[model samples]
Target chain A: MKFIHTSDWHIGRQLHNQSLLEDQRHVLTQIVELAKSNEVDAVVIAGDIYDRSVPPANAVALLDEVVNQLVNELGIKVIMIAGNHDGHERLGFASRQMQQSGLYIIGPLTSHIEPIVLQGKQGGAAFYPLPYAEPATVRHLYDCAASTHEEAMIALLEAVTAHDSQGLPKVVIGHCFLDGGSESESERPLSIGGADKISPSLFKDFDYTALGHLHGPQYKGQEHTRYSGSILKYSFSEQKQKKSVTLVEFDADNKPQISLLPLTAMRDVRIVDGALDELLAAAENDANRDDYLMVRLSDKHAILDAMGKLRSVYPNVLHLERTGLMASNEQLGIRADHIKKGELEMFADFFSQVSGEPLTQAQQQMMVDTIDALHKSEDNQ
Target chain B: MKFIHTSDWHIGRQLHNQSLLEDQRHVLTQIVELAKSNEVDAVVIAGDIYDRSVPPANAVALLDEVVNQLVNELGIKVIMIAGNHDGHERLGFASRQMQQSGLYIIGPLTSHIEPIVLQGKQGGAAFYPLPYAEPATVRHLYDCAASTHEEAMIALLEAVTAHDSQGLPKVVIGHCFLDGGSESESERPLSIGGADKISPSLFKDFDYTALGHLHGPQYKGQEHTRYSGSILKYSFSEQKQKKSVTLVEFDADNKPQISLLPLTAMRDVRIVDGALDELLAAAENDANRDDYLMVRLSDKHAILDAMGKLRSVYPNVLHLERTGLMASNEQLGIRADHIKKGELEMFADFFSQVSGEPLTQAQQQMMVDTIDALHKSEDNQ
Candidate 1:
C-alpha cells in the first residue's frame, strides 16, 4: 500500500498581516498533481487543517475545492484528523456521510477508537487516527487517570491496540510535540508548563507513525516516526527549513519504505544584509526578485525612503531594519539619574540625545508655561 | 407531489445571552419526525440556516445531523438557499458534490439558475432556489440595471424563466423581505433603507412561492405566495405570531393546496404585567412553569431583591422592568441650568434625585479633597 503523508495546511494563515491564500492554493494544487502522478492509493493528513478554530469563508471554500478534487476527481481515499488549532466538531461535521465517498475525518476524542482499514494488492493496512485532545477530556471520556498529553496519548493507543485482533500492519497518525522533535516559531505550544511532549517509544509496536505540530520534517529516535512538517514556511525562523511531504509504501510483508517529496513555494523567503548601495546592487542581479525579503542596512546614517526604494525593485519586501539606527537608539536609553528626574527634565534629556543639541532658552520657557497651564486645568477639575 | 416548507432556522441564535442550542435541536428533531411521518417527497428550507455569517462549531454539527437524517435516513430531498445571515461561500461549500446525495444548497447570485427537478407519484416538479443576493450583486451578476430589490427580483426571475422550456410545474424558493410582510425584532433587516421590500406580484408566474426572512406566517394578497415563518418564536414581538411550517401538496393538474402545521416549542415565550404580589400569585397556577417569561412590575417603590424573588418563582424569567419606578425617574431628568453647574454640583443633584436627600457637609468636604488629590496626580503627569 502506497500513501502520501502531509499535515498543517493552515489554509487561512497570514504572515505579518499579509494574506497567504494565493500561495497556499498554488502549493495545494502542486500537492494534488504530485498525488496524481505518483498514483498513490490514499492520502493522510495528520492535523491542523486550518490556521484557527474558525477559518474565514474563503479558507473553507479552498478546502472544499481541494478535497473535492482529491476524493471526487482523483478517486483516492483521504484520512484526516483534527489538530490543536481546529475546532474538532466543526472539522468532523458530515464526516460519517463523507466516509462512503472515501473521505474520513476524525474529530474529538471518543471512548472507542476505530481504525480505517484499507485493502492493498498484497494485504491490508489499518490507519488509526488519534486526534488532539486535552488530558482532562481524554480522562473523562475513557474513565482513566491520565493527567498529561503523553499519558492521555498512551492510554488512547493502548485502548485501540488492545481491541485490534487483526494481524494487519498498523500505522498511527497523531498531532503532538514528540520529545526529540525540533521546534519552530510558527507552531503554537500544545500545552502550557511543558506537559505536551511525548516519547517515541509509545508507538514502537506500530509499523510507522506520522506526526504533526512540529514545523520541520525529521524523525525522532526511530526512523519510522517522522514529522511531515508544514507545507509552507509559516514564519521567519523557518526560512531555511525545506518544506516537504512524506511518501510511505508498505512492502509485501508490510515493511515500510519512506521518502521525502519536496514542495516548491510560490515565493521564497530571504534575509539580506548590506549597506544601502550594496544591497541595491545585489538586488539588480537577483534571480527570484518576487520573493518575500527582509533587508538590514549597515549604514551609519539614516536613509530616507529606504523601504520605498527597495519595494520598487523587490515588490514583496516584507521588512526593513537599520542596524546603525538600532545601535544609536540603544545608546539613547535614559540613565538612572535621568529616571529620577521630573517628566519635563527626562523629556529634555531624551530630545537632546536624539537631536544632538540641548533645549533652547525659548523652548525651555514654553515647556514651563505648558506645564503650569496643565496644572491649573487639573486644579479646577 | 408533497413537500414541507420551512425557513429562518437561525440555528446558532441566542436569546438574552442564553444558548438556545437545546431548543433548536429539539425543534429540528420535531421537524425531522414531521418529515418522516408525512412521507414528504422533499423538504425546502428557504433561507437563514444560521444566525451569524460564521456559525459556531456546535451549530455546524447540529445542521449536519439534521441534514443527514433528512436526506440520508428519511430518503427525502432537501433544497436550501443562502440568506443574508449566512456566509454564502461557506454555506455553499461542497454543495455540488452533495447534490448527488439529494442535498441542494444554492448560494451567491449567478447568471444561470438551475432547478432541482424531482419526480413524484403524480408528476414532476421543478424547485428553483433564488438565494439572497444584494441588489448591487444581482445587477453585476446579470449585467442588469437594478438599483432596488424589486428590480433585482424581476431581473433574476426573468433570467430563470427565459431558460425554462419544460412544461413542468415550477415552485420558487426565495429569501427576501416581501412587501406587506410583517417582521419581528429577531429578523435582521433584509437591506438598509427601504429598498429590500419587493412586491409579491413578481412570483405570479410560478405555481407556488415559499418565502422566508419574516418571522410571521401569512399570505401576500395571493394564496400561492406565502412566508412559512420561523419554527420558533424568536422574539417578544412575535409573541402573538403562531409559529408553523407550511405543508404544500400539488394535485395531478399542478394545483397547490397549502396548510399550516403548528410547531410546539420546548419552552414558550410569554410576557406578564402586574404588581409584585399579583405576579407572585399568578406564577403559582401557571401550567407551563418552565416557559421563558418577561415580567413588568407596577410596584410604586424600589423593591430590594426583586429579581431574586421573581426568579425563585419563575426560574426562567428573562427580563424584569419596573414601570412605576420608571415614571418617577423620568421626573428626575437633569435641568438645562444644572448642566451649566460644576461636575460635583451635577453629581449632587443626581444623587439627591434618586435618594431624595442632599449631600452632608462632611461628604461635600471629602468630595473636594478627593478632587484635589486627582488634580495633583494629573499635574505630576
Candidate 2:
C-alpha cells in the first residue's frame, strides 16, 4: 500500500502579521495535484490541521475545498487526527458520518484506539492514530501513574499493541515532541518544564511512524520513523529547512520503503544579509525579490526608513535587523542577561515591553497566585 | 413516509445574561426520544440550528451529540439547512461525506437545488431544501432581478420546481418569513422595511411545506403550509406559546397528514404580575418557584430591593418592572414620542442611554458617514 504522510498545515497562520491564506491555498492546490498524479491509496494527516482552535471562516472554506477535491473528486481515502492546537470536539463533529465517505477524523482521546485498515494489492496496513492529549489526560484515561510525556507514550503504545490482533503491517500516526527531533521557533511547547519529550524506541515494533508538531522534516533515529514537517516555513528559524511530505510504500513482505516528495511554495521564505546600499543594488537583479525576506544590514550606522526602502524593491520584506548596532557591549549585555532571568522575571519583562508599563505589585501577586494554583492542579493530576 | 419536522434550535442562547444550554439540552433530548418512539423515517430541521454564526465550543459539541444519536444510534435520516444565524461554510463542513450516513446539510445558496428523496411503502417524498439566502444572493444565483424577499422566494421556488422531474410527492423545507405567520421577539427580521415577507401562495404546488423562523406553531394561510415552531421558548414574549414539533405522514394516496406534538420544557418561562408583597406571599405555595419569572410589580409606593427580594423566592426571576411607575402620564408621553423619532435620533438616544454620555460631534459625523455608506451599498445591491 502506498500512502502520503503530511501534517501541520496551519491553514490560517499569518507571517509577520501578513495573511498567509493565499500562499496556503497555492501550496495546498499543489498537494492535491500531487495526490492525483501519485494515485496513492490514502493520505494520512498526522495532526495540527489549523493554527488555532476556532479558525476564520475562509480557513474553514479552504479545508472544505481541499477535502472535497481529495475525497469526492479524486476518490481517495483521507485519515486525519486532531493535534494540540485543535478544538477536539469541534474537529470531531460529524466524523462518524464522514467515515462513510472514507474521511476519518480522530478527535478527543478515548479509552479504545481503533485501527483504520486499508487493503491494497500487496496486503493491508492497520493505521493507528494517537491524537494529541495532555499528560494529565493520558494518566486519567489509562488509569496509570504516568507523569511525563515518555511515560504517557509508553502507556498509549501498550494500548495500541493490545488492539493489534490483525496480521498486517502497522503504521502509527502521532503528534508529539520526540527525542532527538530538531525544534523550530513556530512549534508551541507541548508541556511545562520541557517534560513533553518521548523517545522513538517505543515505535520500533511498528513498520512506520509518522509524526508531527515539529517544523522540519527529520527522522528521530530511523528512516521509517520520521516527521513530515509543517506544510510551510512558519518562521525565520526554518529558512534553510526543505519542507516535504513523506511517502511510504509497503512491499509484499510488509517492509516499508519511504520517499520524501518536495513541494514548491508560491513564494519562498528567505533571509538576505548585506549592507543597505549593496542589498538594494542586489535586489535590482534578484528574480525572487517577491519572496518573504528578512534583511540583515551590516552597516555601522543607522538608516532612516530602512524598512520602507527595502519594501519598495522587495515588496514582502517582513523584518530588518542592524547587526552593527547589536555588536555594542550594552546590547550584548542585555542579550546575555536575558538567558539568566527566571521564567517569572522574563514574563514580567515581556509584559512591560508589550504594555509599555511595568507590572504593578497587585499584578505580580496575582501571577504568583496563578502559578501556585497551576502547581496544585498538576500535583493533583 | 413519516418524518418529524423541527427548527430554530438556537443552541447556546442565553436569556437575560443567564445560560440556556441546560434547558436546550433537556428539550433536545426530548426531541430525540420522540424521534425514537415514533419510529420516524427522517427528521427535517428547517434552519437556525445555532443562535449565532460562530457558536461556542460547547454549542458545537451539543449539536454533534444530538446528530450522532439520531443518525448513528436510531438509524434515522436528518435533513438540515443553514439559516441566517449559521456560518454557512462552517455548518456545511463534511456535508458531502455526511450524505453517506443519511445526514444532509445544505448551506450556502448554490445555483442548483437538489432534492433528497426518501422512500416508504406508499411512495417516496422528494424534499427540496431552500436554505436562507439574501435577496441579493437570490438575484445573483439565478440571474434574476429580485429585490425583495417575495421576489427572491419566487425565483428560488421556480428553480426548485424545475428540478421536480421524478414525479414524486414534493415536500419543501424552507427558512423564511411568510406573510400571515405570527412573529415573536426572538425571530430576527429577515430584511429591513419588511421586505422579507413572502406569501404562502408560493408553495401551493408542493404537497407540504415545513417552514421555520417563526417560533409559533401555526399554519400560515393553508393547512398544508405550516411552521413546526422552535424546540423551546426563547423569549418571555413566547411565554404563552406551546412549543412543539410537527409530525408529517404521507398516506397511500400521497396525501399529507400533519400533527403537532407538544414538548414540555424543563423550566417554564412565565410572568407574575401583582404587588411585590402579594407575589412574595404567593411564592410560599408555588411549587414551581424555580421557573424563570418576570415580576411586574403593581405597588403604588416605591419598593426597596424588589429584584433582590423576588429572586429570594423565585430563584430564576430575571426581570422586575414597576407597572405603577410606568402608568404615569410623563412616562406615557415619553413612550408616545419614541415612535415619532427618526431612526438616527433613536439610535443616538440608545447610544447615550447605554454609554451614560451623549455622542460627541465627531462621533455623530462618523455615524452619518456610516449610514451614508450603508445606504449606498444597499442601493448597489
Supply the TM-score for candidate 1. Answer: 0.82
lDDT of each: 0.82, 0.85
Question: Could you tell me how far off, in angstroms, the CA of residue B255 lies in candidate 2 after the best superposition?
Answer: 2.6
lDDT of 2 by residue, B95-199 (tens): 988898989999887888888988854567999999998888889999999999899999888867887547777899999999978878677666544577899
Residue B193 deviation, candidate 1, in Å?
A: 2.0
Model 2, A39-147: lDDT tens per residue? Answer: 7888999899988777777888899899999999998889989887777777888898899898999988887788898875456789999999887888999999998
| Candidate 1, superposed: residue stretches over 4 Å from native | A119-124, A162-168, A324-381, B119-124, B162-168, B325-381
The residue pairs found clashing in candidate 1 are none
lDDT at position B5, candidate 2: 94
Query: In model 2, which residue pairs have backbone atoms overlapping below 3 Å?
Result: none
Candidate 2 CAPRI classification by DockQ: acceptable
Candidate maximizing DockQ: 2
Where's the lowest-lDDT run of ten residues in candidate 2 chain A?
A372-381
Which whole-number lDDT from 0 to 100 does residue B332 have in model 2?
Answer: 50
DockQ of 1: 0.20
